[model samples]
Target: MYKLSIKKIIRLAAVTLITCSLFSCMSDKSEQSKSFSVQITDKPLTFCNPITLDFGTDRARRAGEAVVAIHQDDYYLFITGLRGYWYSGNMRDWTYVDAPDIPGGCPSVASDGERLIVSGDKSRRDVYASADPKSGVWEKVGYYDREYGDADMFIDDDGRYYMYWGWSQILPFQVVELDPDNGFKEKGKPVTLFFGDYKSHGFERRRPEDVIFSIFSYRDYLPEENPWIEGPWMVKHNGKYYLQYAAIGLELSTYSHGIYVADNPMGPFKYSPHNPLTFKTTGFMVGAGHGSTFHDKNGQLWTIVMIPSFYGGRGSGELALFPTAVDAEGVMHSNTEFGDYPQYYPGIKENAVANNFTGWMLLSNKKYVEVSSTLEGYGPEKAVDEYFLTHWCAATGDPGEYMKVDLGKICDIYAVQVNFDRHDAKLEMGRGFRMPPSLSQYQSYTVEVSGDNENWSMLIDKSNNTVDNRHDYTELAKPVKARYVKLTNVFTHDEGKFAVKDFRIFGNPDVAKFTKVKDIMVVRDPDDPCKAKLLWQPVDGADGYVVRYGIQPDKLYNDYLVYDDYTLDIHSLNRDQEYYFEVEAFDSGTDYFHEKTRQTMGIGAEIELFRDREMLARKMIVEGKNEYVFENIIPGTYQLRHTFGPNMWVGDLTKEQLIGSDNQVTLSEKISDLGVGTKVLGQLNIKVIPGKENGKFVVTLNYDKP
Candidate 1:
């Protein structure tokens, strides 16, 4: 007979108790059936990160330094190297329009309650304006005689215009007032605002863990660690001016944004306590810098930043968006925890504190995958590992090459994001160049779903697409129940291989929510304030945990995702700052809760050590921090059985004090013959460490298990 683990039985009892107590009854059939009815009522309005944009006809498929402007209830998106811009009425669907009059690289846009003014990076001095941006008509309205790197234009409440521009390792950010009445000419000399403080701020340093140093800084000419303070943006909130800029370097994953507040649009400014207003260095999408912020039609604030992808070449990337806000205490910050996951657009959920994350966990991360073919070092598993640096590439860009994901069970699939990476593509144009719209290549594919791995149904069909969509996102018209999802390649752009960085699936499993994570421990290094260690007790039914931390407990804006681990070491923190942390456990599509439905050995049942239904070793239940060593065994599948009794705990209580109950819960589905599949190459040790929970223990299975 198949035996269930003691931990699994206890969790089932806990869920049963909670459910019965909530309803105040257990025998009524109507009450029991109503409890399991669908909890979701509405189709969530959500968007995933690396915000899908019209990547244009660029050979490199890269964009960065994004800026967003709103005019006449419409949103305009401008990015580096694109010949034109994109406009969206609801921020979900964007339409691209060519701007022949405006030059491309690092463009910025600002609206003056009427016409929209646009400008480009350092070398492009000619400025353009459009009364109707959607119509694709722009006129050269102004020009700056002097070159300004990463320039941004701001129009204050009093109709005063100010221009902020600077991008240097040895220069501070500068701002000068512009006279809008006089062809947008400069009205005053540019004032040096501030420079990056790498010594005091560890996040401003140049490397992944903030360990590298640049040549020099503006204050001290001597060789020292320095950072380029670029991409200056301005926003006025409650009579306070918030000047934000990207720091470090664009190539590093730690590239982030910091904020400074002032009373005037161009004046003395102080760094906010929350130094890096936006930071996302640890998730599937990294780098939240060099972006623009704007208010939606519902008055909610949002920021769109650049996420790096240097595969095409250096300085290559896509864009991402996050919900941003300033608290009542005037603290400016952005919520980046699960920033790359599915999130509701503005006004869907009014509470900014809770964030807009749809709670649809990533279903395909590290799950079993099967592909039609693979190139060397580009395995199928890489496509679902939740990291952008790795991908799965088929041997050729053939029409029938496909990638499939096994969700392990039937799940409520809500959305799917397919991130196609450029692998061995024909280089039609180099960096900083745009291809003619007619020459732009298109990607065509079809997404299908299956339940029993044989019969399939179409989910998302883009086989006849004409647009250049690299990071394509599809929110299903209706959520479907599926066990397998497959993406078949109909066409690939530029004769590139069928490569995918991530085939992310979003959904919920048919299981109860995971219990809260407890016994969290944080140890900040006194010798090096930039580093810290976090440890927490593992929670049952959790596929992973998100560590949320920040300067204030109520303002834990930054977060990191840790999978299948109880401990983490963080190195991206400010040296001279204090932070508070909290961890939350989340359930994904691959959780082991499905085992609860499987039939198992009775309570207090002991298994005669078995191998393929044959006795092999003595019978005993290992408990506490004890070691168990089995004698020499053959290379075969072994069933590691466990049993539990009512009120049977594993903690500090003595065996005599434990009370046994008479309940015998029988599950319906029979458990499969699965166990520690291993070869007897060497001695393998399994350890059980008692956890703080009443009847739970941490099991460590050792072997060549990835």
Candidate 2:
């Protein structure tokens, strides 16, 4: 499981005390110039999925199953996706700490209030022990030979330690009793715990493609029908043991933790009617399968699961928190459908109710971007795109760096999320072998809201903040009505290279209702099977529509928000895999009185193709290089479908091109260069005709797209 938590209970209850005065926009002007803030990690490493694991140093690290154990004093030790461990006062954000043990593959650790036991996935030969993991000094326990496909240790209330393990297409996941004193010796035979019937379990099927991995140590597998049920984790509540195992791979968009409930510590377990207790297949991101669950200081159930992320063709996933609950029927569920959408954070549930959304919509999503300065190709609009994978960065590393948004009008402001980003910070942090990961840099800034461009007041201040919160969601003590807001960074920890992933503001405005239209489904694009088309019945009172889709459920940052029809065409989809999408019908006043504009919108606006917005075409990312291979070509008119925008170019395919079967084709920069017909969208829509082999060709591009 991927969730980790260690906490010391603090009982300071109650927050909405009428002690402070409720403030309002009194002196600010009606129209003013202000700025907005977005939220982003300091540095992120993009993998096949790109967000496998995040190291503290602003460097994104790819990771697998992780564990969390209690540490001395109320601290929690986050065993990383890699070899080291991270420390956190709160389970949300963490700091890095190094250990002497070898790191590779999935590792597991467990704590029994006082001491801890651990194991790594490599070899699966031995276990380790430590009285104080905070010190990072652990002694070897013992070696074992029989087997442990994957190791996850669990300590019962009575002090008994049980180890669950497995991961394979052919083998079943299992669990066995262990002797904690003797390096967790096998006290009993390992029993097969889960071999779900994928025939009836739709969620257990493997991804549409093979386990085509390149980022991790393990890669390449022929995909079949049955799925890989790995990462066994057991948690007991009310005498019922819940056996959770991760199912499917890149299918996290539809992946889940097949849940099985047992009467005794051992078998005779039955599938929970609520199987896949933690399952979410739609939204910005894809998967919520392999992760860990824990109780917070207040004893509320919470699970941290890996976020399914795909960029290029490889699946590099990340982790996020999923608020959980066990109903009266004793069923557990991970509230993940709106997992990536803006919602009240989990830690504050103690002071607020489970549902704390104020119905405030994203006020500046995709708003025009204004900046003090910008880096090459990093447009201002990126700061407001709402996609976590993209960001808007300043050109120079200097103080006073800022990004501003007009917001189109004055509105009541409620909250702001500042997404900080790290781009090539490793070049400056001095990379070394097997070093612990942590963020050493910090930002200290002041946000001033204004009504007029000239007049301003401090709305929020963090100049003296000693804490580092990655997703800094700041809510005013009370709603502050304002028109303009400006964020000025007076200081930074490292070189002041100002960066932000998004500047999102939530507010109460003349908002349109989201027409949760029915009849939702996805099919391969009829014209281009490589793409997808999402068609739904138009809402009776709706004016237009917005379609949001992506490889992951939580990171559905890619969108076609301006469509005004029932059917939406998505050309930017990853061809090798399936995707998740959401459709919303809106009556954004503009379509209300303007009859002519409304007449021209909707199905009539369907695009023939979405111009390439990708900085790079989808490819397979290896340890050191990204590979792009185009397979199966039919003889016909052909064009390299990619960005025709400025300063963008693709690698030459003439040399790296590979032909197989009856495939054949030529590489040229333009139609004139190919000595063929006229160019369309900057390149030739050349007639492929037919090849001597048949009527197809394949092209492979190496290095970066020009």
C-alpha lDDT score of every prediction, in listed order: 0.67, 0.51
Q: How well is each residue in 68-106 modelled by candidate 1, as lDDT tens digits?
A: 877887777788876677777666556677666777878
Candidate 2 lDDT (Cα, 0 to 1): 0.51
Question: How well is each residue in 252-298 modelled by candidate 2, as lDDT tens digits?
Answer: 45555657778776777787544555555432344666766665554
RMSD of 2: 17.7
Clashing pairs in 1: none
- Which prediction has the highest lDDT against the true structure? 1
* Top candidate (TM-score): 1
Candidate 1: worst 10 consecutive residues by lDDT? 9-18
List residue ranges in candidate 1 displaced over 4 A: 1-44, 55-60, 208-225, 312-315, 352-355, 428-433, 436-441, 509-515, 592-706
